[model samples]
Structure formats: C-alpha cells, structure tokens
Target: METTEWFSEDQATFGDRVAGAREAAHLTQKQLAGKIGVKLTTLRGWEDDLTEPRANKLQMLAGLLGVSMTWLLTGQGEGPTEPTEGEISPGVSDILSQIRELRVQMQDNVKKMGQLERQLRAALKE
Candidate 1:
C-alpha cells in the first residue's frame, strides 16, 4: 500500500489555494494571518509565492480559509463546498476560531480608529 502525503489529494500550489480560499471567504491577508496565528508579513509571503506555509500552519490555514485539509496543502478537487457561519463546513472548532478572530479584528480596528480620530481632533485644534 502506498502511504499518502497527507495533502496528496491536492496537486496545486499551496499558496494559490490559500490565496483563493482567503478571497472566497472575503478575508484580508492580515485577517487570515491572525486567524492562523501567523504574521501578516508571513501570510503575504505565502500568498506571493515567496515562501510556502509550514506544515503546522497549513492545517490551521485550511480551517480558517474554509477548505479541506488536503486541498489547502495540495490542490485537491474543485475544493470543498465552503459552508457559511452556520452551515456544516468542517467542525465547530474552526467556526469558533473564525468567530474569535473576527471579534478581535473588529475590536482592534475600532480602537485604532478612535485613536486616529483623537489625533485628528488635536491637530485641528492647534
């Protein structure tokens, strides 16, 4: 029996699949990077084909991007039928991960904007 390479089902560039799924999910590289516990620059490198995502981040990337584990690594089929927030995509774990990520991003952006507004007001007052 031939041993499988885990992502053997997929044969395309992992970077392409990662970039595709991220786009399909309507997420930015930073968002996807944060979800997978990676740096935004790292995600950029992955998407730009400058470097490949490591084995560990691969599984997490697939989960966050709403794609099959194999497909994310290899280039499997037409890819998995990505489920929405409530649909049956992979498991509750991935969904929860995504939710938490989104919450963090929203909060961060809100705080950043608030700070920016304060700075702008100070500048206008001067």
Candidate 2:
C-alpha cells in the first residue's frame, strides 16, 4: 500500500526529522528504540514514516538526541550557528546549556536511585 505523508507543504512530520537525526548520530533503529524505550518494530515504523510519536514522547526523544525541539518537530533551525569544537557558537551555547541541565538531572537521578537501593536492602535485611 502507498503510505500517506503526515506533513503538509510548509510543515515536516516529526517522524522524518527524528529518523534523520538518529541516523546522523550513527545510531541504528534498535539502538534508537532502546534509548527511547520503544520497541524496535515501533522505531522501524517511525523510520519508515508510518506514524508520529505522542507529545511527551516526542519531547523526550528530542532531549535524548540533543537537538532543539523546534528543529525536531518542525525541521526549522533555530538560527544557531554550527561551530567547530570549543568555538562557542550561539547554537552551541544553547546546546551546552541543555547538556548541563541534563547532567544535573542525571546526577540527581543517580542519587535517588542509590537511596532507593539502600532502602530496599535495609528493608530486606529487617
């Protein structure tokens, strides 16, 4: 069967941009699927442009891939320049800020996980 395109004249579908970015990151469908917590077949469907991701999933996917949500959702670049390493372009700065935020969140999650693990062990010992 012929696949219907999800986007219009001015807009690009969220799925296509996601698939392209994933490929650009040198990730396979299975790897992207694992990262996004989706099934491999579901990821393949997205890659084949079969359907769009839900709202929250889209945001999480964009965050995990380190691309701007605007670019991921609408294929529009947010006027940030691409620079070489340590060049500090405007876009790179924005990306770096996001990376720092993610790092903080990850550290918090690790601490929380450790606390939970300790509580579980203590309970089990009791």
Candidate 3:
C-alpha cells in the first residue's frame, strides 16, 4: 500500500499524520513549527507522538497543512496523498515504510512493557 494510506488509525498515530502532511506540503519541522507558532521541540514532540497540540495549534496546523482536523486526529478523512515517483526513489520509499512500521511496533512494545510493569506491581501488592 502507499505510504499515504498507511496513515490509517490502525497503522498510524496523530503524530504520523502530522508528519506526513507536513512532508506532503513540503515543509520542514522548523518551518511547520514556525508557521503554526509553536516551538521546534513542541513540533518534534507531536511528530514523535510524545505530546499533542492544543486545539488552537491543531486548527492552525490543519489549515496551514491543508488537511482536515478529523484526518489529522483519526486518519479517516482527507489527508496527504502518495508522493510521486519523481519525489522519491522506490528503494528509499520502501526503507522509510519499513522504518515507520518498526517505529509503530516499538511504540506498542513500550506500551505493553509499561502495562506489564504495572500489573507486576499490582500482583506484588496483592
């Protein structure tokens, strides 16, 4: 499947959508943050899924990036389209796709580990 379709809720997070849209719009992290009136680190956090934007910023991001708020949040509406062949080599695209999938898997593993730790603590207390 194309990288654009990979932004579905089950496959990607809000951060992923944000990053994809920003890239599609040809904006760098710094540029997008500046345009959205946020700090570069704040934008980084959003792209990394470590934090989220406030409503105002979210609105600004959606407007500036030309994507729907719903798509940014749930990946269920209009969002970034697939990059053209001229924009990226097939080999590079494949590598990026693999990297994104691995990132999602790593995030899931971290969540699972955290849950297991909490469960172990509760069991010990009981």
Candidate 4:
C-alpha cells in the first residue's frame, strides 16, 4: 500500500508546510491570524505562497502550530507524522493518541471561548 508522507522538505514548499501545520493544529485562517496579530489577508497570502511572513510572525506561527520553525520552513526538525501500526511502541502510540485528543479539545475550547466573548459583547450592547 502507498503511504503519504505528511511532511517532506524536498517535496513540499514552505507554504504547503505552513498550511499543513495549521490544519493539523485545528486553526482556521482567521483564528491563526488573530492569534499572530496579522490580517486575514496576510495569512492567506502566506498560505497561498504569494508572500512570506516576517521573522516574528514566523516564530509565532511555529509556536502556535506546535512545530519547530526549522521544520515549518525547511521540514528539517520536529514536525507532524502518522506512523503506521506497529511502527511505534504501544505506549508511544497511546501517548500520541492522547496528545492528539487534547489538542483537539483545546482547539474546541478556544472556539467556544470566542463564541462566548462575542455573545457577551452583544449582550453588553443591549
């Protein structure tokens, strides 16, 4: 069976890596832009490979996506991977699965908080 290499520096561009990481982190473009203090358009540009982020933004992006800057930029360090069955020890697999679940929960919580904030603002205006 064929397998997809999720991250390969030689095969994917920088923008591709960024987009992949962002998706893996469960962040929408707007959400990530807000966190990084950039405009939605700016983030789109980066993901589209039409432009590159400055150093500070790059650092922030790496942090927010839970990836190393080197990996995001060149796919040369810690990055996402999905090992096949038996590829990792059972304990390692369990830990990884737990971590993935926690990340999803965290992202969901962030979304819920944002919704509550918006609702509170609307209420305050009444």
Number of the predicted model whose TM-score against the real structure is largest: 3
TM-score of every candidate relative to the true structure: 0.50, 0.49, 0.78, 0.61
Clashing pairs in model 3, backbone N/Cα/C closer than 3 A: none
**TM-score: which is higher, 1 or 4?**
4
Cα RMSDs of all predictions? Answer: 14.4, 16.5, 2.7, 13.0
lDDT of 1 by residue, 92-118 (tens): 546645655565577689999999999
Segments in model 4 whose C-alpha atoms lie over 4 Å from true places: 81-126
lDDT of 2 by residue, 1-126 (tens): 121222221433566567657755678888888988999888777766787678787777777777777777666763122344555566756665565556557768999999999999999999
lDDT of each: 0.68, 0.65, 0.86, 0.79
The alpha-carbon deviation from the true structure for residue 80 of candidate 4, after best TM-score superposition, in angstroms, is 2.8
Task: Kindly provide the TM-score of model 4 when superposed on the true structure, using C-alpha atoms.
Answer: 0.61
Q: Flag regions of model 1 displaced more than 4 Å.
A: 1-12, 78-126
RMSD value for candidate 4: 13.0
How displaced is residue 113 in candidate 4, in Å?
A: 50
Error of 1 at 111 (Å): 50
Off by over 4 Å in 3: 1-6, 111-115
Per-residue alpha-carbon lDDT of model 4 for 1-126, expressed as tens digits?
122344445556688788878877788999999999999999999988899999999999999998889987888898765445666676765675565556557768999999999999999999
Ranking of all predicted structures according to TM-score, beginning with the best and ending with the worst? 3, 4, 1, 2
